[model samples]
Target chain A: MKELERVGLPTVHVCTIVPISQTVGANRIVPSVAIPHPLGDPTKPLEEEKAIRRRLLLKALEALQADIEEQTIFGN
Target chain B: MTYRVVHYINQFFAGIGGEERADYPPELREGVVGPGQALQAALGEEAVVVATLVCGDDYFAEHAEEAVDKIIGLLESYRPDALVAGPAFNAGRYGMACGALCDAVSKKLCIPVVTAMYPENPAVEIYRKDLYIVETSDSARGMRDAIPKMARLILKQLNGEPLGRPEEEGYIERGIRVNIFRDRIGAERAVDMLIKKLKGEDFATEYPMPSFDRVPPAPAIQNIREAKIALVTSGGIVPKGNPDRIEASSATKYGEYSIAGLENLTPETHETVHGGYDPTYANDDPDRVLPLDVARELEKEGAFGSLHDKYYATVGNGTPVAYAKKFGEEIAKKLKEADVDGVILTST
Candidate 1:
């Protein structure tokens, strides 16, 4: 992804862990969900889980398209 | 019998244009093109160039999963006996692409694959262990020598020949620990190495430390209301009884506790298990350190969408960075699944 971004393509990485993402030098990241279950909250109701996942996916799309000068953390 | 081979190269080598065209997606052409011609000539008649796949550096980087999947599909159709990626020299992205593609070909296609790049190219760090990554000069000027070396290595793999050491084969060492018998004993080798070092002569260390990859932060949040925030701490705050019994120092595990029903954390309900600092202040009102009080106020005011029902806790003090990394990964995956948008991380 670094190679792709270096060549002027937009990229976004979504992670539940911030430090690991930062350590890896990911310049565009959106923090969402958790590690074991990144897209859904198993404890939540089905509709709620779907809504939660949808919000994160939307955020990720925005993050991928945004321009960044340095490593920045994105959150809701 | 002629062996079918697929040649992989970057946009620059394909003459699709330079970095300006680096965003170009992967495309396949029947038979040789651009540098493929030179590569084909070097292969002789025993090998026949079957196809060439060209992708822009930026394109592959941004769409790695898709790019590799697409490339894999293209190659499966050709059913090539061997895969040859670029002698990428010192071009960072090109080197990465070649190394990554070759790795995929070797793993997924289960075919013999070969590539060449400068030893310094960052790709060598990740992909060298897969197979033959011949050493090349830093630019296209060394293309002459790089071609045949890669060709020879792949041909050897095809012939099922026993391989020699990297030094003899003109490839970089993968730094794997192989227990080959040596002429000198451990004590003697250590003494010999010490003398060489004292004399300022070159002597490679038996074990080289691995370097970590550094990454920049992601873009900042643009909208607060649309965000779903969460709280996380390395300050060792947990339920008063500490159900998980996480250690005070060098903690081996982390805890995820629900903050779903709380307006504020009470002294009776929460306390610190961290061994590095005084617990008096944090124990007085757990909210001071964990900040559930402040977060609740914001949640009521609609400062952000909503707080994640759970927050993670662990002790940062005295924990190994490696352990910390593992915890971070696991926690992040959980938070990601929960659809958290941002986090408020506190450290003592």
Candidate 2:
């Protein structure tokens, strides 16, 4: 992701483990769900799960459009 | 007689409890525990797991130094030839404990140690440069493959054998620039690489360019009074005498201190232990770096609902990025658990 960003490509490093990604120096971040299934949890109902996935995808798009300087974290 | 080795595992693997029991503290027991049993079997007659150390993820995060010290004392009494930590897979805290302990064991006890975890296990980034970490699948489904690989690497370390490339050995890259005497010398190697690059036929570069990765910045808080804010810093401020002994530089640990009843930081009560810069000013007025005094005043003025009683501190100078990330995650979780709605991170 860093290499991709370095070449003037807009990138958002998406993951459930924000701290780990930040430690690796990931520039743009979008916090997803937990590690196992990054977008949604199985414990949630099918519709709710879909909603979770949809929400994350929206956030990833939001992150790409956002501008940042220095170490910054995106997503709730 | 077999190679005596100590095993480390977390509470969940030990069958003690799950998240509810995550504050179970540290304990030492005879014989192998959950994952250790598999490790012992893989080790075969060449090695024996003499004892197992179990710790809760929360407990270790809360009291790292004390827990590590206690575990080390237990390990010293056993006098094991080597230490083997988990095939922790994707488990974050377990992987961290294993990585931190293995690193400590290697440095303090002067012994070889090995741990297995998923490549993204967080600990890999922190301790990999100082230890050998076998790469494994993200879940325990990869156990059968991981055990053998970890055992092979640990045995190699025990016997002081030479290791091949990371791909060849199934271990993650440690990012250390090793000086090896090449068969053809630097000029020949350079020419060979140049020709291969010009050919553009599956050429591999010996050096890769470095890139910096940063975050996009989380959204700012909307309401002040409704938001509970926690304070975090890499400024190395602590109670007088530096109780946690966080290193002046190259810190491996962090401290969480409560400011529940305190309104301002006094010179006699707090001081800066960081060695990278002048500490006189920070010592004279600890708030200059930590900003507890201003934070309290801001709270009274309703800039935020309430300040978290506890503030997390760790020395940033010379600290590895991995450790810094670990501290941040753990402290963030603690603050979140305390119902903190926002965080105020101050750095020196």
Candidate 3:
């Protein structure tokens, strides 16, 4: 993500481990669901899981569209 | 029993000449040369400075590969058990030569190699990971102090003795983690640290975070409706069978899959090879890791302009920072050429 940002391409990282993302110098971050399944929750119904993933991606997209001065993790 | 040691020094150190003779070509001499006398005295009778390899700083810097090859060739005949390079002080070129020479000797000749330089020496950043470099003062005035530490370290290495921490051994920290047993359990230690922290007392962390490279945030996407966004992942999501064969851990390569027509990732169409986590969750539904399903949905709903046809994937489990940076640069270059305006990098 740092490389992408260096090359003028705005990037956002979606991951469960926000501290690591911050450490790696990610400029824009959005927390994901969990480690094994970052987007979908197996316990949820297919539709609900899809909703969860869509919400997360929307947050990631928002991060890309929104300017940040420093490493910022979009609150869940 | 006597241990044989080879010493490397720059043109300035050999008393041949200073800046003018910085172009001196590599030369091999019979025994102790200049500073080697001091090193010999420090090594005592246990180790003998078998020979000295001298080279001009400019010559070595300009022709590094050849210089290393030539020096290693000269060193092979000596059959030295260990090698010592100058306490280069703060001389950038000299420190570089010593670091490079020591690095090559240790690798090619399988000998213990040691050098000393000021902590701020530019070469320390480049070669500290590969050499045992004792910290030194900025000038020859510290030679007396530096030589003994260098000798002790090389001797310890030659004897196969366990080395203490960098502070105790008088060497710059190499940032390498060594596992050692502690009397107190981790929870107890954590509590102790917490109490110290709450009391404003000093405490050291067991694991120190390495400094990282920071990049200024790029300007926000101005035209979200027309931006060409790309998806990149360190989640190890790839086509079934992993055609690129990216390692399950410590991946050396990344896979670029054509998601041109793919609306979603199914277990049959995609799977994850990341070894850091249980694959059952990811393999059962790769979209859980890559999120292409929801991404496609957003694209269809006109939430964004378009998704790039090609998506990059690599396993992040235990991958080296150097390789990860390399992969990121390459991937970003291709994305830029493809006119990708933004990216969503998913990590698992």
lDDT winner: 3
Candidate that would win on DockQ:
3
DockQ order, best first, reads 3, 1, 2
lDDT over C-alpha atoms for residue B242 of model 1? 93
Native contacts, share recovered per candidate: 0.11, 0.08, 0.89
The TM-scores of all predictions, comma-separated, are 0.51, 0.50, 0.87
> What is the interface root-mean-square deviation of candidate 1?
12.1
Residues B1-348, candidate 2: write the lDDT tens digits: 578888888898899999999998889899998878888888988999899989998898788888899899988989999988887898888888888889888889998898888988888878888888999999989989888888888888888899888878998888877776767977887888888878885666677644444544454345556666666666688999999999999999999999998998878999988877667666766765566765676678765578789988888687865676677667656665687655544445
- Over B1-348, each residue of candidate 1 has an lDDT whose tens digit, in order, gives 788999999999999999899999999999998878888888888798999999999999988889999999988889899999998899888888898898888989899999999989999878888768899989899988888877778777887886677877888787766668988798998998999999999997776655555544444456667677767777788999899999999999999999988987877899989887767766765754566765676667766678789988998678866787778777777776777666655555
Candidates' C-alpha lDDT: 0.77, 0.75, 0.93
Candidate 3 per-residue C-alpha lDDT over B241-270 given as tens digits, one digit per residue, 9 for 90 to 100: 999999999999998889999898988999
Interface RMSD (one decimal) of model 2: 17.1
Query: In order, what DockQ does each candidate have?
Result: 0.07, 0.05, 0.87
Candidate 2 backbone collisions, by pair: A25-B213, A26-B213, A26-B214, A27-B213, A27-B214, A27-B215, A72-B215, A72-B217, A73-B217, A73-B218
- List interface RMSDs for the candidates, in order: 12.1, 17.1, 0.7
What does the lDDT read for residue A1 in candidate 1? 30
User: Distance from true position, residue B165, model 1, in Å?
Assistant: 2.9
Candidate 3 wrong stretches, greater than 4 Å: B1-6, B15-20, B28-41, B44-52, B72-81, B89-92, B106-111, B118-130, B137-144, B157-162, B173-181
